[model samples]
Target: MTTSSSSSATHGRSPAGLDVSASFATTLHTPEHIRIAEELGFKRAWLYDTPQQSPDVWMTLALAAERTHRIGLGPGVLVPALRHPMVNASGAAALERLAPGRVAVAFGTGYTGRRAMGQQPVSWAYMTRYVTAFRALLRGETVEWEGSPMRMLHTPEYPRGAPDTIPVYIAAIGPKGTAIAESLGDGVFIMGIDGVSEEVTKKFESVVYGTAGSVLGDGEDLGSERLRTAAGPALAQLFHISYELGGEEAVKALPGGLEWLAVVQETPEAERHLAVHHGHLLRLNDADTAAWNAGGNTLVGHTLTGTAGDVLARVKDLAAQGVTEITYQPAGDIRRELEAFADAVGLRR
Candidate 1:
């Protein structure tokens, strides 16, 4: 998995009268990066589950756990389809042994993970089953899997036999996924806050779910050239996702959508996944940045890119909309953007 730092930082509130907290999200950073985030006062660190591009999430989290103290650490969202629920249950239990109460695991329907294998996301029913069983396994309780009853064999070694202390966060984009999260997960993980409807936010509020979403860029102005360059990779991913998931009409709805669609059409289908996620969480190349910039019209529609104050305003807006936490995911220079976001949100060491 990759690295993505997120938390419902109730330890303090921002200066905007919003109780929301700021955190960081990384896709391919080492434990040292997570240590820096902890020092920067981010309440938690999330590791993304992108096996196609990053190292194993559990190993990385283990390293982070060893290097940092006081910061919450867990997989931003682990794709259930990639591993057996029992295996993940053991892994989560092991991680909790290392980090104790600081561990949390989120489950996603497998976006990049499945795409890399040339497959589609697993069904909601399948995910629900996995989560239910996984939760039980973490509780060190016997659960009916497949046909017979099963339980973690080594529960006697650990006090609870499972990592019941770990919270499970569910990543959802639609009503079906949200419903699964509400029923089976302790929290909800969203990609971006723009598409989250008021009705959905109300549901999340009612459950007091710890919500986390991506904020793409940073600058002194919302429409600054620098902001565009910084936010390019994320914007490109959006375009690619729209085209890949929603087809030609969806692409048409985006800014310079048609042009981006052409870029995808020209590429061999097999390579599209890698191309869309190029420089992902790291840095975008000049050509990719230009293509992403060309699709800039759709940037503001979903991303939170602007001056510090602008970003703060957007954070306030999100908090009002019921988002308890924000995950700042910037491209280009990662530390510069992380420090800028920390400064903007008044999160100090």
Candidate 2:
């Protein structure tokens, strides 16, 4: 199973707040999942940015807004390099208009998946620069830098200076990426597999979430603590879930497959993802292993897991760390998953 550095982090390093995170499904049923997240009391719902299988990011988040209230939403993460900052700015502003204070956008530097679209991975500095500029433009401010070319066909009706600046978060993992998040983002959505420790993440979370305010300025609810605690555990658990089941099948769905098992066991210092692939492979079978692994700590860290008590425990733990919001994306069961979480958390009515 996958786990986040937040959980792996030591108590000394754990942050002051914790927020929830979730993702949009790629299928037609996604809207339904959004509704379920709302009903389940998950405060944040995320729409993903996969080129091949994912749905339109802004449209999906907009669809979600129409269906629910009291829940904040945004794209799980759009690649900063793929679309120009202007387009990203416009889309984010549009989303803010739709959900107002409930809107926040997260970006990721190009990942393995973005390459499918002929997009190259972006440097951390560039990603930071692009996102900072995008946030500025979204707030209805003028920016000096020129970003890549982009266009948004379905723009949100401008609120005409309704504080159009929606919070912009980045989905980053690893030390270099985390440093970027701490430096450049309002918050971060961390990803993980079994080997990565929650303690490692929580230590980072404590620092970032704690400093979100001084860095971003004002809006505690919109500050760093409102950011996520970490990612990975939930996805690992998903591998152990019902539909996917926990076996060799699930292992193959992840990155390494058999290669992970052979390498990770042999090499501790081997590439982390390679180790994760192996750990996942060892923990599960191929049929159940997810071929795709992407999310803003939403699918893996906060949603889809053990008992209601287990979820409550996880949520509370993060909350204690100062996470004021928890965006829930129901990647698991729409009805049962939400129902169980709502029952356990008592946040859902």
Q: Pick the lDDT winner.
A: 1
Q: Tell me each candidate's TM-score.
A: 0.83, 0.60
TM-score of 2: 0.60
TM-score of 1: 0.83
Q: What tens digits encode model 1's per-residue C-alpha lDDT throughout 236-306?
A: 66666776688779877877776666665665876766555555544554434555567553465456665
How does residue 332 of candidate 2 score in lDDT? 33
Q: Which stretches of candidate 2 lie over 4 Å from their true place?
A: 1-21, 115-120, 144-164, 192-256, 259-304, 319-329
Model 1 worst lDDT run, 10 consecutive residues: 206-215
Lowest lDDT sum, 10 consecutive residues, model 2, at: 208-217
Error of 2 at 256 (Å): 10
Q: How many backbone clashes does candidate 2 have?
A: 57
Q: After best superposition, candidate 2 residue 312: deviation in angstroms?
A: 3.0
